[model samples]
Target: MNTLFTVSVRRISHVCTLKPYKETKWLMPYGNPTGIYVYNCVANQRVPVILSDPHIATWYSCGPTVYDSAHIGHASCYVKLDIIQRILKSFFNVNLVTAMGITDIDDKIIKRGLETNTHFTNIAKQYESEFWLDMNSLNIEKPLIITRVSEQIDCIASFVKKLIDSELAYVSKTGSVYFDTSKFPSYGKLSRMQDEGEPSDEEKKNKMDFAVWKGHKPGEPYWDVPWGSGRPGWHIECSAMVSKVFGSQLDFHAGGIDLRFPHHENEEAQSCAYHNSRQWANYWIHVGHLQVKGDTKMSKSLKNTISIPELLKTYSADTFRMACLTSNYRYSMEYTDAAMENAEEVLNKFKFFLKDAIVYINNNTATHPCQYKDSILKELQKVQDGNIEALKTDFDTATCINNMLNLISSTNKIIKNDSSGYYPVTVTLIVEYITGVLTKFGLKLQDGSQENIFSDMLIDTLVEFRHTVRLNALSKKDKELLNACDIVRDKMKSIKVQINDSNKTPSWVLIK
Candidate 1:
């Protein structure tokens, strides 16, 4: 069966307990309220999602501006979004085509270029490359289409011209193009902005929308448009790119919570004004921001921001990912060095448990292994069965991972208590369960394209390496040979360091 169809069926099965839903169709996690679940939607500040059309799943996420290194805050949202897409494929088996637009042309790029006396395009490209490197290091699934703002200038110019013709936008005397927010009645619907009693002079008489094109400015990159050579504003680029790629309306729209204010609201306003409808997106998904420890928000200006590259130098990408997933998707993640270390400790423990399980299976392979009676397997199966329900309820990843961790810990406890010489061949199931959990969380236990090795191989590698070290120390009377052996050990250590640094590894038999 197709992967998408299989996952769709699982998602359908999860919600069948409520009202009878057709299995052939898939529902998105949005829509108007119905019955008791109406409040559940409000809790997340969205209506309950009943995907009447699973095929309605066109997804979009806001990408980086490419002016600087990506911060951990950005990484959190990107990784979480990637996991959402991956888990849908894994558990719900939904085939989703995800896209994000990179803002290679922006004010920030130009400003940084001016400060450094370099070309804006070069600066943007450099940062964009670094951003992708960081994302790859974290094993973030790349967006299917990474549309660049520089490449999409033609589309953006055409969009602005259409909006001008529709009387939804206009050019100022300075060639600055702005969206006519007043033309769109539901301008702040998505963010639900509160309106004061009466509009002030600027608010009432002026074009209320954000700038679509910021006419030519000093030392900034300029593009040819009907309104003259100028750059597009922060908000309008997304609207133009999304409209060109996914049509006028998208199935789902997402961004960091901070973008929900002026950026997304303005995009919604501009898009709807041009399209002439209240529907800009079928579902709006906003990820909460990551905060600095004990702070309300993380900001580069405040010097509280931690870049992905800097953090990766200290902890493995999986550990960082674990920290990201520990909090609810809708809640803020407060990152600190201590938090990451704690997550690494837990991950190391999980790895050790897996090692033990492997050892048990190897010890038990002697018997015919008829009826497998692993308590760990039973717990894992139960968790897998119920995880779908947790996912369907607004993608409750925190709960889902919690259930998985409980199973891992419980299984470890069971293995610890078992005194029987029958170490149980059912450990294979336990290893697989751990793999499933790790994979769903965007962590790959097995190295890519390489066949997995037996657990004994891992033990043997460490043991052999140790044995070689002792033998060389005792047998080699020459200090120079001892130094050479030490160099080899150092080289292996360096390889381990590099592997850990890049968050990459090939299929392996043993650590040696």
Candidate 2:
């Protein structure tokens, strides 16, 4: 819904007994009344998200055609959706089963194969492997099920045959099949596409009709289906794959906002015709485009695409992920060096605080907490709850991320002052909270071994300095120098470092 900030007066049925919703202001585009109101592109309104069973939800998302490298635009869609999926799981407790279709048999793949004098399947497989690698590199969670168009030819054929039998589709003279949009009364409801009276194609009865199966042509791969020896259409591939995976019903349908038009609309029509239901998917989700320098949408056709591998080469995964989170998912974001730099700064803030906090806990922790009471733990809990609220209202990551950062700032102040805070329990709990939020967004964290090495280096530096001071005091028998050694000893005691000074030379042992 990147192009959508349209107002709606219609109210949807979202009266789930499990949770109650409060009225919220729709002042901003992704504003509150945030009781899980998902933007529906079909209705052009923010419809309240409601599930029938509310226990398990079924979802399907469209995947790339896999003819070439997946770009940042593609990464933007999948990564943002993955964040929303995480929010749904953590905040709403919705156990979702998602499936994505891989378009391995497409015109682009065949054309590339022909140009390279290679087999189409080989071309498809090569890019398909690259697609998965890009997805893993971005840390996007793998879908529960994956369906490839090449492997699903028979199932797609069956779906098209059913539509033909119902008279909602027809077999063209060339043995190609097209959807008869004239027959389906609700043909343009999803996209609301008005007929501009464009001339009809030689093979189609109406200008609105689109191919469900393209008849085989010279130098093209084909399967011997009952209709013809050709592959499936791009739109029909999703409809058939969804039916094959989740049967007639689905809880959610997701894709990039660019797909809202003919792609998603066509899928809805064919699936509804196949299932004999008014609704093919209960909720529709679409993420915005990732543009370059705030220009037009990035695409291979425009030669404006930045590949995911190329971006990852320059910046960490957390950098890209943080950049995306800075803007809400439903709005198109500009990818600039400035934007990435800002994201890097934000990431380092939390990261440095976490690292320093952990080291402080390890080296300055006593057997008990601070002697005075502090309300830092309660403040951390409030941040966590505030994040939940932000996500509930359409996954507003901008607000949620700000909340986490604010808590980190305040906690850092308290820790720096050596204030009346419980370092043992409060600091430990703060670490857990920050770690959870970072992991939730798929941001990489320092590994356990790496943190241990860093801590050891700090201890080595401290022990070497203390040893130097101790030798001076023992050799000179200087009382003032000896008192400085006592100060170091008191500091070491807090970290369980025991020093013995009852000898010519003092020895210290680090407690495990």
Candidate 3:
């Protein structure tokens, strides 16, 4: 008998250390006080998330089949799922344990090996490394447990044996093993797929039945088992990994919408049959497809798919994330150059606003008790409330982003008016709040590392030189000196730097 696995949880003293600004009249609850709702694909309804343990949550996502380089289509699914995890951690303060499975020994990997005359293991490792590089480039959070199908063959074999002993599966004439779908009446509960007329192949007993283990073929990898010598089937691999890592039940199961049919449905059926529990997962979340601009799905055969490495070459990770956030996670988004360009523009605007605010706070030391503080605080509270509310309702990142934009606009308006005194404390709080929220979305203010000390000194020296030149020009009314100042401004702009001349001292901000 196989022992069920249980997750160990440790009590964390502080999940979030950032405090809200001055504890306003509006108190935004951190935990799921009102019950967070998530869209469940099995029920086809938005269901409230009921956690098995209040302090910890367990979730799983289907990972890549390491046959080739991962494309943007894969990136979209992972990034969206990362956002979901971030929301749970940042907003709900839940300790999360997430797992993803890698199919390293799939049919596709075998085919690639034959075509290239290379070892399948070498190919799997090459692409797996590339996949991690691309994931890092996109700033995706790493899963706690990344199980490869190759490493779980023994477990998979044991699981297949259990089904066989129970007569839920059988050994075929070809020495292969197949799942007897007839034994499980709720086989199509997840996919809602109906049986076709007849068995497609004469060798199989039923058309609905799928392979649990394949017989060994010529020049293919195989493992010795009691009944046969072959590899585990695609569906059995995931089920086995989940069983070993997370046991029978999962808090959430997420992947692209394309996996809903045969891939995820089969896994669910086998898990339910083996564990004898109808509730395999509490919530099944599926992200929409990332389509090409012309309404065609991205596919390798179409030769129109964009790889993550190629995308990062042209755009920053935050830019790509921002483009994904522009649409709802449950709706399809078109990948066009125009869409990415628009995202970049929005990101630049945010950087500029943040730079200006930081500069104003640094230069001005006088704290003015502004008449507009009460009004601004009220508006900020409303925006914060809207952001929290949007995320609570199925993690609507688009709406949350809209609320952040509103907050930015309000901040800009207050700063634009000279009559309203600059409240340093209030501005600091707003900046903290904005950056905190943006970080949760996997976006940061600066793209790369900060400027080195020497580079910073060079910039300061140049700014001081321009200031001296401008002063001389004003005192002596010299056109040449003024023209030299213009030269400095143009030079800075060419290097993607913006100079602010409104303050007593000239300050520069780098534009990523």
Candidate 4:
């Protein structure tokens, strides 16, 4: 019975919208294109992504309160979403319009402001700037719309008035306005919390009724509203801003897994009531927590959260991203030093594999074309199909990442043992394809160590240092010494110096 109802809700959700995706030249559907699928938490299953228009979709992500620096928890959610967003736009050919709210007027910000002797907006601005830096560092795409709660007070107030006028909400004697949850029969549908009929406070008609507008109080901000001077409720902030921007139905609503309860449930309820529709958002995509110390979630109140800047200080952005994608987006990921170290090693494997392939391509002038083009093509096909298949199963990046590692290992076997000469450029095709996929996954690739700890000239120094040492090691025939030189060469990188040595040496002069 529960499954039936859930299925019905999902079907009706898409009905609220109009058209769907296509196979070819968007306007006129041609062949059968692969329909995108996402795990809709509300439906408790994987469902086809739908939009009113086949070419465009709408998404609204619940962003941070901007009271402090963003942490790994935040990175885990936004970065994963960014990867999915890029795939949808580039591969799926969907023009996604995304919006994220900056919760500048939350109680957390107010408390932080008072504690730091700063105004709430000032605190919001400071951290918001830092938040942008973190997002850029992670290569998160900027949302098409950025709505701030402080700037949307008028719109929120207008939404509240409409709800009150429609009897879906009521203004309390304290001048606060609350959404009457009793009027919305499906209030607990999303969260699955048992319905309650407990007695309410003097201000609420029902205990479950949540505030839509908070009355004016000392030491807090206020805005003029029909129900006296008050501020928008935390739950109403998203509904109002999203509705003002996208109107009635949305293709997707996303946030962290923790938001599924009161925050998201409340937001969904009010949006449904205000829009006078059974379903306001088609899909609820909630990302899992980034935990630490065995299921202890990283959070501000927990004091165990690792900030983005701090994590970036030790690891590259790509490494951190790999750590987050190590598990399914729906599963909680533990952040430990070992986990980060593993991610770094995996990243090194990818870079070293590409570097070796490129070097082979450059040095094959005297050799005949690779004897096994068909076998090489088979491997390339596996990578291409594996990547697409992985993404198809609800953005199963964990599977995709694993497949990539396995492919690298398999491809290495051909490179190492195969004695037959092949066109060096054959492997170059594989390198380019892998790099393209990496870009789609929102990763920045560079030769050598991804670290920027040393200057560009230093890469030249290391490469030259190793090259000068190479001849001595060959005479000595020291396996360990040769391996160490290989390591140094792989770690050396300089963009300014155009290095095309048949022996993989930097030939151009240093810019400085």
- lDDT tens digits by residue: candidate 2, 1-512: 53323444233323222110112111222112325777766556776665655656788999999889899999989999898888777667788898999999999999999999999889989998999999998889999999999999889999999999999999998888999877665666656775448647888888888899999898899888886688898999999999999997677889998898899879977887788755677678888888885668888999999989899888877788998888988889888888889999998888888787766656544433342124675687688788877776778888977988888887777667765444533554566667767777777765433542234444444455456666766889878766755755765664466766644444667775
Q: In model 1, where is the ten-residue run with the lowest total lDDT?
A: 34-43
Regions of candidate 2 where Cα sits further than 4 Å from its true position: 1-35, 363-375, 419-422, 447-512
Clashing residue pairs, backbone N/CA/C < 3 A, model 1 = 4-93, 7-92, 7-93, 26-54, 27-51, 28-51, 29-49, 30-49
Q: TM-scores, in order shown? A: 0.76, 0.79, 0.80, 0.81
| TM-score-superior candidate, 2 or 3 | 3
Q: How far is candidate 4 from the true structure (C-alpha RMSD, Å)?
A: 10.2
Candidate closest to the true structure, highest TM-score: 4
Give the Å shift of residue 351 in candidate 2.
Answer: 0.2
RMSD of 3: 12.8
Model 1, 117-204: lDDT tens digits are: 9898899889999988989999998888888989998898888999989888878778888776656655666555644344343423
Q: If ranked by lDDT, best first, what sequence of candidates would result?
A: 3, 2, 4, 1
Q: What C-alpha lDDT values do all the predictions have? A: 0.66, 0.76, 0.76, 0.74
Candidate 1 stretches with Cα past 4 Å from truth are: 1-56, 194-204, 364-370, 374-378, 418-425, 446-512
Per-residue lDDT, model 2, residue 65, is 93
- Model 1 residue 426 CA deviation in Å: 3.2
